[model samples]
Target: MGESVAGRLFSVLDAFEDGGPAALRLTDIAARTGLPAPTALRLVRELVAWGGLERGADGRYRLGLRLRMLGAAAPCPRGLLDAALPELRALAARTGGHADLAVRTAPSADGILCLVSGDRLPPHATAYGKVLLAVPPAVLPRHTRHTVGSPGVLARQLAGIRTAGLAVCAEEFRLGEVSVAAPVRGPAGTLAALGVTVPTGVPLDRVTAAVRAAAARVRPPEPPPYPSP
Candidate 1:
């Protein structure tokens, strides 16, 4: 079957993804979406009318405010913040390190639901990102010499990470930053990750232990046992 109007419209938006250039001219959109000039123009205009895209003075288009607001309202982003903030705060206080929580994200044509992509780190390079990478990305971008860009090497590391129940990064993401993280599993599997970043020279012994403990404490709030009669 032929593509739907909605599908064509979304192709225009996806042309800006992969953290690519912020703006594109009409021809860029046409080429990216593989649509003819007139068709691309029509779809672009429709999106502009609906506030889903913005056209600047240079006639370049960019994702607009409406799309960002909608992305912010996704269920996983909201739920992860509510569920992990308390544990994050406590973990930071006890360890004297930067503590964070992240969910794997899945971006579909509509918006990002949380799964299938690393949200806060390079899945092949960071502590929390490794265990959360249930589906590895096709391309691995290198950030440092320590980054495991080779697929075979990363595959080997992932095996050990699962067995150990945590992943540790020693200047893998950046030259001086070090981190360790533990996965928070749900009935379905890993739902999120809790990570702590300590100074480069600090021993991983204490922070590693702390992150594992904190990850166990992070959980989504349960629904009420009974509805009102």
Candidate 2:
């Protein structure tokens, strides 16, 4: 049996679930999604026409604003995001603030893999991934020359993240991009992460403060007391 048309189209978008948060070439998409090159190109063209994908000047493709909006509406198994979207939006509206909520984080197959959209960035190289990842890896994947691949160094970073309740990555995954993230936890522990990506020298002190505030606001409201038996 062959894959459904909708599944094929979804596969193209799913291909970007990991790796650096960088625009992907058609070849990269094809290889990642396990689709043929021509097939990937055809699907990408349809997505671009339908506004589900955006192609940049460099001819790389990324999820379009429309697609992202739809993603925001998808069912959240934990219902945590229902309390977060508003705060995330407010944070994003500020100058240079790219706000996000952790979609999910995969098992530690490769020593703590971060999963899609927000999980697209490398855990060792981005603030969002770093905070969500509980254990530091023995060997970190290097996304750039500046990436912190040293396990010892990364352990210290993780320790700081736990202590400060935040993480900050400075051009570790890609030059000119900085990320700050904080964990959103409930009684069960981190339900998700909230973060912002901004450029260098953008007053990180202020951005970090804003992100922390937004994360705080995303806490699920207290449940009403049960009726007296």
Candidate 3:
């Protein structure tokens, strides 16, 4: 389908997905969106004027603080995440690994996903990334030798995740690494997932049970569609 006007606008913002706080040159935006340089420049300018994108001292583009504030207020699963934080922390503390609260990106035809991570991990091995990969053909970037490159295998893994109400990875996305995850449901319905990471040889079943127990206590947020222009 041809890009919707809203899609073009969002494409400009999406261009900054990996930029962190750094200002991106015109070429960077163009590369991220596969748009021509002239098109990227025009769209970026529009976003800046809207207070969604900003230019830095070096004359490169970044997400404005205004946009960051909006992101902070976005309503998807926020309530559940808040309720689950203490429990997630306890799980992480007891496990001495990593933890996260993840929600599937709305408007996609895919499996569950994570919204944030509690610690930095190899892009593939991180509990958050792997859960996204648990589904087939998810939008994710590879970051390690153990990353699951095959969509079919990952699809099977996702089924395991759904059936068991948990997912586990043992060197599937990295060497000498493993993790476990459980889905968190809200009073409204399922909204996000909770996960924990531990080194290989740890008992995954036990960790997954703890995450599930925590999820059972919280009410999740209603899944909302992405904002429209």
Best by TM-score: 1
Query: Compared to the true structure, candidate 2 yields what TM-score?
Result: 0.61
Better of 1 and 2 by TM-score: 1
Error of 3 at 165 (Å): 1.0
* Pairs of residues clashing in candidate 1: 105-115, 106-115
What tens digits encode model 3's per-residue C-alpha lDDT throughout 121-155?
33234455444444444344465666777667666
Report RMSD (Å) for each prediction in the order shown. Answer: 5.7, 6.4, 6.9
lDDT of 1 by residue, 85-202 (tens): 7888888898888787766434322122222121335677788778777545566778899888878788888888888899898999888889788888777777677887787998
Q: Would you give me the overall lDDT of model 3?
A: 0.63
Q: Which stretch of 10 consecutive residues in model 3 shows the poorest summed lDDT?
A: 115-124
Number of backbone collisions per candidate, in order?
2, 0, 4
Model 2: per-residue Cα lDDT over 70-178, one tens digit each? 5555554235566777887789887466777764433432212222242345567888778877776555768778899788888888889999999999989888888
**Per-prediction TM-score to the true structure, in the order listed:** 0.70, 0.61, 0.62
Indicate the TM-score of model 1. 0.70
Lowest-sum lDDT 10-residue window in model 2: 109-118
